[model samples]
Every structure is written in structure tokens, then in C-alpha cells.
Target: MKTNHPGPLVGILSARKADGSIAGNGPLFIALQKKLISLDGKSFVFIPEDAGIDHIMGYTFLPEQNHWKKEKFRYPDIVYNRVPFRKSEQSEQCQQFFTILNEKNIPYFNPCFIDKFELYELFKRHSFLKTFLPETILIEGKKDLFLFQKEHKSIYLKPTQSSKGKGILRLRLTDAAELQLDGIHQHELFKSFDHFWEKYGVELLTKNYLAQVEIKSAKYKGNRFDFRILAHGEDKGYTVTGVGIRQSQTQDITTHIPSGGRLLPYEILQTNEHDNFIEAIVPEIGMALSDRYGYFGEFSIDAGVSMTGHHYIYEVNSKPMRFDEEEIEEKKMEQLCRIFLQLSDYEN
Candidate 1:
């Protein structure tokens, strides 16, 4: 890849595998590197522990060799945080690396993961956006869970720091006055609140969990469905990159693919009303997040339309995973490259 006018040097901060290759989605990174190269730009993947003040040990894809090659590079003009896990991002080494980037005045977006409880609180402060959020409360004791259940009848308990529909449980009050609990792997019923708390709710007090009202999402052919909207920041504000639909296979508690959900054709749910609704909300959500959490290059929103025809925002991921849809993935790569160039002030 050769060009007379090359773009800026961008560094992707991520984890390293045992073999020292960059960890996470290799295909996504390879594709991104190729896209940057097409624009005559240079990019590399580096771990926080390997980053230095002057030069960092990093890996760049060698198309000729068809593999990643390790090398040393100067601090990038801009950095994109893609650290694979929450624990790794919280390490001392990662903190120190960011300090170095700050000292050198290098720009970076999405510094860390966003906590679900904190995000809910942030949305509550925004009057317009708050209405779209489900009523959420941090679970501290059995009393909190009981009160929430009594109010909503059915609620979802979610780990604040988890993703891919992990550690989420749905609890509903049956007409028989029993508690019905449904998890990804387990389903059971309790005769009384005490029984439920003794078995499950007691453990939630020890961890960070949020109790949220469950949205009765609209369904397609008896399967609950939702939309994943990818957005990227631009000079003016944020723009929607692409939208993909995920439908639950067995009408499960979540529409996440890992939790037995399947991706459907984008055209299946496309409509003028849906398009207009998304257009009205994406900019507001993006700007609100930026104001509260600093600039974010890109983020993905998990949202659904209720059976009552109202839209609800379920989750926002700062570090988004790879979209399965080909068109969505392609658009994401292109938009991300554009954001990198704009942030680095690269003249393409």
C-alpha cells in the first residue's frame, strides 16, 4: 500500500496474546489496518504495558507476509482504546500509559468502560433522554429487589460491568404469588420472597447489580427483537453508521446474539417511522454522552421498540464488539477510519 499523501499514525490500545500478537478480534483489526493503509495512513496495535514515553513496541500487519510484525513506533498522533477486558483496562500499567499520552498531548477517545449504573444516573440527569431509559436502581439488598418487583411486577437484574448478555436474570411475579426466575441457564420458582432471597437475591448484594424494569419488546414471528445502532462522532456531532436487527430465538430475556439470538435482514423491520425515530434520538444520545463522559469516537446502542410502540434504550457499549452483518461491519470500518483521520488532523 503506497500513497503520495499518507494519513496520520493511529495507535490501537489493546491486550496482547500469549504469543505477543494483539488480542481481540484479529479480523477487525486487520481490516482496519488495511483501510488506513489505503488512505496512505499508518496504524499499529500495542498493549498498555509495552507503551513508552518516546517509543512503543507495537504490531503492524504485513500484507506481504500475511501476518503481524512486531516493531517500535513513535507515540501515535491519536489513540483508540480497544482493551479487550475491564480488568486489564484498570491495571496500573494501563493507567500509566494514559498518563504518558496525556503528558505528550496525544489525543485518545473512549478512555475506559462505562458502568451501567453510572450510565443510568447520567441519563436520568438528561430530561429528554431520561424518558427513554427504563427505571433502574442499584441493588443493595433484598428490600430494593422486593420494592422494584412490587412496582414493575417483572424486572431484570443485570451485572453493571458485564456484556454479551452475561449475568442477567429475569424475575417475574406470577399470579399465584410465586416468584419466577429465569437465567441464561437456569429457571426456577420460589414460593416466597424469603425463599428467593435466600437462594439468589442474597448474593446480588455482594456484587454490583442493577434492577431495571423489563420492556415488553415488539416481536417478529413470536420472537422478541431489537436494534443495534452504531454511531460515530464527526465535526458537527454524531452520525449513525449502521443499524442491525437481532431477534431472540426462543423469546429469551435478551436479544443478544450470544444469548441465543439471531441476526435478521436489515430490511425486515425498516420503516419510515423507525427511521424517523432513530434520526431524532441518535444525535441527542451521542451529545449527552460526550458532555458527561468526554469525547467518544464511537459507541453502539442496544435499543428496542415496545409492544406499545414506544422506543426504549437498553444499553450503550463504549467498546463495541464486531457486528455480524456484512454491511454494518463495512460501514463501521469506514466511519472509524474517518474519525481517526479527523481526530489526528490528517489531510487526506
Candidate 2:
């Protein structure tokens, strides 16, 4: 289990061969490398340096037809596990590299512990969260989707491993010929299950998708309000750093920032009386998760509220977006750095 990499190092693993967030989306991954470089100690980023690495060594692997043919690295201190991730498909190369890390016992910021569906399994166990969680069924085709929709009327289709509203669709019925989707509006209204199966059969077949009955989300401007709860692992526990609401702008079903949503102050999330309700509830949920989900202290849980005033957890992110100041603040970065050090010691 020994190699030549130095102690307390950070390796930002990339799951994807090419990503749009090579710079903007990889702050913590980049910050860990920068912190290493500033120290008079040996440090290097293991990806492409121009990908916004300030002081760390950057490494790269050549790709041929979406395959990592050749890779170069001297080894790393700790890995941030910042791999570009696609939930539905696992690349053989990514699987191999992950195996290598596992065999090596390298510390990872967010260890490969859980996936989206497993998180749902965890969510269903929460007494308070279970009711708000829509009746969900993993479906292979429109028959399954149609059965759920026939009863629920409105259903949300999500990829097994998705982020930022990509491949998320809300289906509704109308008297027309195609199905009406969330962001796309009332464009297609599927008249029969066969029609839907013919159009989106491949997506339903190959992709691991789940269908959940839609919740009438807590509304702001008749759209929806969702809380992006940011928490981090520290000695005290998984602490709720901040809770911001992502209110969908217009013509969007989700409140994800990349999908035409804007962040609002926490207070804007509730009325004067309900603000205290929110404050009280968030801490309780945070405490429960910290106790149960061993090692995952830092994350963001996307929560939605229904018209009936119930809060539903949409998704929980193990490796969340770093704060705007994480790059500049040394003390906070040090705390996060410590978490990486502790979690990386997986063998212990």
C-alpha cells in the first residue's frame, strides 16, 4: 500500500475526459492543489495546469475515442475525487482508475461510498422525509411511466445519477398527442403509452431512470422554491454552513443554477413566522444525517417544499460546490483540508 507520493497530498480525480467546468466548476479540487503549492513542501496538481491550477502540479491522460489510452502521474498525496461524473454510464477506464485508488488506499475527499439510488434508500427511512418523498418506481419503459402517471397525473423522471437538472423531465397528461414536460412546457401530450414508448424508448431502456410522482412545490411566483442546503464535515459534526433558495426563473421545472435559476437569501425562503421553522428544521436534519451517514459530513441537500407545506429532499450531493471564498480563505480551506486527510485514511 505504499508509493512515492508525499503526505497530505490532494488528487483531484476527473471522471470525465472533457468537462465544461474544467475551471469554474472545480474550485475545491483546484484549491486543495493551491494550498499544497503555497506550502514550502513538495506539491503538484495531477491534471492539466492551465485548467486554472494556481500553484499545483497538473497531470493529463490522452484520450482516443473516449478512452483513456495513456495517463501520466508521479502519484498523489490525497485525491479530491473530482472526477467528471456521469451517473448512468461507468467508463471502464474510470472504473479501472477507481480500482487502482481503492487498491492503493489513497484518501479521497468524497469516497466512493454511495450513489443516488442508495441515497434515496437512506431518504426513505427518514420518517419526516418519507411522506414528502413522492411514490417512486424505477421504470424501464413508458408502461411503467404511464402507470405511475395515470395515478399521479404528474410525474418526474430523473436519471439514476444526474446533476443540475440534466435529463430531468416532468411529465403531465393533456387531451393532445404528446406528453407535456416541465421545462419544455405543454409542447407534447402523449395520447397513449405506445406513443411515448416509441419516441423515448431507448432512453427508457438503456438509462437507469426513476419515476416519482410530482410534488406541487412551495411557490414563490407560482413557480417553485427549493433550498440548497450547504453543510461541511468538521470536528463538531456536519454543520449547516448556509441554506440558499434556488427559485426557478421561468419555463424551468428545477431550481438548479445552471438551468436558469437564481439563488436567494435564506430569509427569502419563508415568511417571518416560518423562517424560524426553517432554522429549526435544518439543524435537526443535519444532525440526523451526520450521525447516520458515516464520513459524509460535507454536502448539499436540495430540498423542495410542497404546496401542503411539506419539505422534500430532492438530492443530496456528497461533494458540493465550494463556497466563493474557499479559494481565498486559508482557515476554512484548512478545515476542509483536514476532512480530506481524515477521510483519505480509509484503511483506518
Candidate 3:
């Protein structure tokens, strides 16, 4: 299987494992490599430290060998920032690698991890999108938290820099005058707001957090569900690749699969009006994000239909995780390959 556009190599910037393989989702990388090969393009995964003046020490997949081959290659036509963790992406070496990409004029999309608070602010600026956003405030102190909780009664405190539902706290003010706190592990009842803040304030205040009003998401069979819509750039705009549903297993604070959420059939949403809502807003979101954040080849939206039947946008992830659904995953791979070839202008 030979590719005519072999020169337009795509580089996936990621962390290296202890054993020297590319970190992040292993199956996703392998699938991406195979997809690019089928498209008559090429891709490799490299760490920041592997980059050099004129070449990069990276790993390319060999179909016959059934292994990733370590080799030196010329700078790729474009780089895809897939650095899995925020800590790794923010490292000095990663910063230096991005500088080299800029200096050499190589293109890339999804530059870095977007702060949750900053993304909310960006979306708030657009009048049409503003209505869909939950009332959000940057939690700076007990005062901010208290006021937000008072206004919404039920609010979610989330770390601005974290993902996969990590570091999330849900606070609800019950009619009994008790403040209830729900997290990944424990649920506690605080006698008052001050009491809750006294215990959790230091941790929340010291780190960046955002307080958002809970949407009371519509549920199915007693489990709250949300839509994960993946979109990719095409013809100077973005189009929907697929939509997936994640339902809460324990009615946890988030619908993230890692946080005790389970996948549901997409058919559940296909019969509802929410499907139309997702289709309408996804392209708008992609355009707004790209306009403000620069070229975004791909992104995924975490959205829900409120109990009142209104659509609300919760979060937009720059680096989307692999979809468990086979159809969505296939569409994602096809779109990824097309986006890579289009961005690199690979002639095949």
C-alpha cells in the first residue's frame, strides 16, 4: 500500500510513554494511522523532546510488521496537537516544540487546552449563543460561591483546567436549609453555606474554579443523559461527524464515561427534537470557536436538553476522546483523515 502524497506527513504531537510508545489512547492512534494509510496519506506520533532542527525522532506504523517503527523523518507538513494531559502540554519542552513549528511555518490546529472559564466567556460574547449558556461565574472566593449558589440554588463547581469530570462539586440548597454537596466519591450534608465553605473553601479558592447553574438535564429511565457531538472542519467550515449519548449510571455530577457514565443507543435521541437542536448549534459553535480560538480542525460538544426542554451547552473540548459507538467512531476517523489531507493540501 503506497501513498502518492507521502511527502505530506501528518505529525501527532503527544506525550511519550515510559516504554517509549506514544501516550494517550493507544487504539485511537492505531486506528488513525490505518485511516491515514487508507487515504493515501501518512502520519506519525512524536513527543516534544523528539523534535530537532531539521528532523524529528518519531514512530510510524508498519502494517506488515504490526508495530510502530522508530525513525528520523523530515518535519511534517502539519502537526496535530494531541498532547493528552494539560500538564504535559504546558511543559517547557512542549512550548519550545510549538515555537519550532511556528518558526518553520508548519500548520497545526487545536493549539492548546482551553480553560473552561475562558471558553464560557468566549461563548457569552456571541448574542445568539449567549442564551444557550448556563449562568456561569469564576469562583474566586467564598463570596462568589455563596452568591452563585444563592442565585441558582443548584450549582456546579468545576475546575477550570480539568476534564473528564475531574474535580467537580455539585452544591444544592434544599428547602430544609441544608447545603448538600455531591462529588465523585462522597455526598455530604452541610448545615449552612458557611459550613460548607469552611470545609471546601481553601481547596476551591486556591485553584481556578467556575460555578455554573445546573440545567436539570432531561433524563431517560431515571438516568440523566447528554449528547456528545463531534465535528470536523470541511471547506473552511465545520460539519457534524457523529453524535453519541452518555447516560449517568449513578446519577453522578457528570455524564463523562470515566465518571461512571454508560453509553446509550443514539436511536434514543434520533426520535427527539434534541437531535435537531444539536444539528443546528454544532456548526455555529465550531465557527465561533475557530473565529475566537483560531483554526480548530476538530472539537466535541458536551450539551444537554434541560428538563424544561431548552438546549444548553455545557462544555466544548478541544481534544475529543474516542467514541465508543462504532458508527460514530468510523465517521470520526474518516473526517479526521479528510481534515488532515485538506489542511496539508495533500495531492493524491
Candidate 4:
């Protein structure tokens, strides 16, 4: 939709409370708004409830005055979606907005939710990327678990669409041949594999999971850690804007910072060679995904380094959470501006 705003109007779409205020990640929304203004661009926050075919009522942050100003705005030129939860993003209004934006040709970042199982299949098709991926298989039922257990001492059964290390089951076979199931909250030990199967039973078969051989990752302060490479797309190509290390806070499966994890410098895990290798591959992965599923403005790729220095990709986040570092945060803002300006330039 056309707008009379002096600068290109960008919209930060998010989930809101009953009062029409953005509910989650308030700092991120505010940082993005101020950053856009710094680049002589304007943006506002809009929720699904405020969105309509022709216009949307949104809230703009005035950094100078340090407050939000409400206004009725035309459909923005570009929408930076940060709706945290998948269910909220999949709501009827959000789904309808996606269709409307596509019909109007309004560009958006991370246009859709991508499943982990599908992503694994995509990565498997590329021979060159095989070394960077751990052995992974889609778990259909009990059979898949039994087969995976036969080969690996430890394996992780993760939901296809899960976050924050939630609902992940880590199965380990000890020297005594005992089966142990470890999760965020629950931990159980069984004398036999059959006994473990009988305990979990049909509950395991109902959910979609990926059976992946657990990597012996590099550890810092006794906790396993991984690197998060934040990459953003520009007119030229995809660029690695920032990198950081996430160390697991507990003995859990994932090192997601939100799950009691701590942020570390990217240098702690990577050498110059490792950085170069990752930087070279980041754009390739971005392009490969884009070729398969259209354009994406950004992605957070989680990669793990083994004790022997071998690196492997663990996950690809379409909509990533904000990093705690100020430098990384600033870089993210810069990338956001690049995405908005580049798309706006093309459309005009």
C-alpha cells in the first residue's frame, strides 16, 4: 500500500496484549524503532488485531521524547515480524496478513515457519554440506529410536518445531547397558531398552521428532557451548553481521541463552580459520534456503565445534532472538536498516 510518510514506513509486527501494546521483547522492538529513525527511516509496531486490508493502527517510538506515539498508518512498505511464539504467528489474522502481503508484493523477513525435519532434508541434498551436519533421521516411531540407539552411545530426540530446549529427550546408553532418558525436567534410568520403550510407549510415537547423533561438543567451564552466527541478506548478498557463543547453563540438551545459558565471545570457540570457513558457508546456506523457499532477510545458524576441532551445524533459526551483547545488537540494527532500505529501493 502507498503511504504519505516522508521516509519509507517499516512495520514491526508482533503479538500484543488486550490494550494493543506489544507484549514480548519490548527492548528489541524499541531498539529497532530507534535504529530505523537513526538511518532517517521511520517504523511502527503493529499487531494482528490492528491490521486491516487498507491500514493499520500502530505505535511509533519517539527516541527524542523517550515515549511511544500512536498513529494510523498505511500498510508499511516492509514488515519485520518478531512474533515470538509459533502459535500466535499461525493465528488466523497473522496467516491472512501473510497472504495479503504476498498479494500486495510487500516484502517481509523470514516469510514462513520452517520445520527442523524439512531443513534436515534440505541440508542432506547438498553433498558439500554433509560434513557440517550431524547424522540425523526423522523418527517415525519406536523403530527409529531402536535403530538409532544401536549405533550411537547418545542421541537426541528433538521436536521438529520446538524452542528453548523444551521437550527434548536425550537418550544415553551407559557401559552397564542401562538406558537413561534425560530431559529439561525429567530424568529416568531403565535397566533395559524394552523397559524404557514400555514406559514411554505410544506417547513417543504421537509426536514428530528428529533422532540425531549427539556431538561431543567443545566445552567451556564444564558446560557444552556452541556458536550462533547471525547473518543478514542485502542487495549484494548475505553477510555475517555478528557471532556469539552460548554456553548451556545446565546439563540440558541445548545452549539457547534463554534457557539459563550465558553469552560468550565468538572468539572463545573459533579460530581465524574456523571463522573464515563459517563466513564462507553462511551465504551459501542462506542462498540454498532462498533458492528452495524464496527470500529471507536474516537467519541465526547454530554450529557446534567438537573437541577435535570439527565443526557441524546444529540448527537454523528463521526468526532468531536478540543477542545480549551491545555490539551485536547494534550490528543487528544496521542489518535491519539494510534490509529495509534495499527492499524499499527495489520497490520504488
After superposition on all CA atoms, what RMSD does each candidate show versus the true structure?
A: 2.3, 7.3, 2.3, 2.5
Q: Which regions in candidate 3 have their CA more than 4 angstroms from the true location?
A: 1-7, 17-21
TM-score versus the correct structure, for each prediction: 0.95, 0.72, 0.94, 0.92
Clashing pairs in 3: none
2 versus 4: better lDDT goes to: 4
Evaluate model 2: give its lDDT.
Answer: 0.59
- Who wins the lDDT comparison? 1
Question: Alpha-carbon error at 110 in model 4, in Å?
Answer: 1.0
* Clash counts for the predictions, in order: 1, 24, 0, 0
Predicted structure 4: lDDT: 0.82
Clash-forming residue pairs, model 4: none
List model 3 lDDT by residue over 88-111, tens digit each: 889999999888888987889988
Q: What is the lDDT of residue 66 in candidate 3?
A: 92
Error of 2 at 280 (Å): 8.5
Candidate 4 C-alpha error for residue 305, in Å:
1.3
Off by over 4 Å in 4: 1-4, 17-21, 346-348
Q: Give lDDT tens digits, candidate 1, residues 58-160.
A: 9999777898888999888889999988888898999888888888878898878889999899889988888889889999888888888899999999999
lDDT of 2 by residue, 165-277 (tens): 77888887766645676543435656676777777778865777888778888788677778776666666555556667788886557777777777777665556544544
* Model 4 agreement with the true structure over 1-348: per-residue lDDT tens digits: 234554578988888666745776778878878777766678888788788779999898888899989999988888988777778888998988888988998888776667888888898888767668889988777777797888997998888888656778899998888998988768899998899889875666676778899999878778888888899996757898899888888665778766677888887666886787688778888887888877888988888888888889888888877787789888888888878877876234
**Candidate numbers sorted by TM-score from highest down:** 1, 3, 4, 2
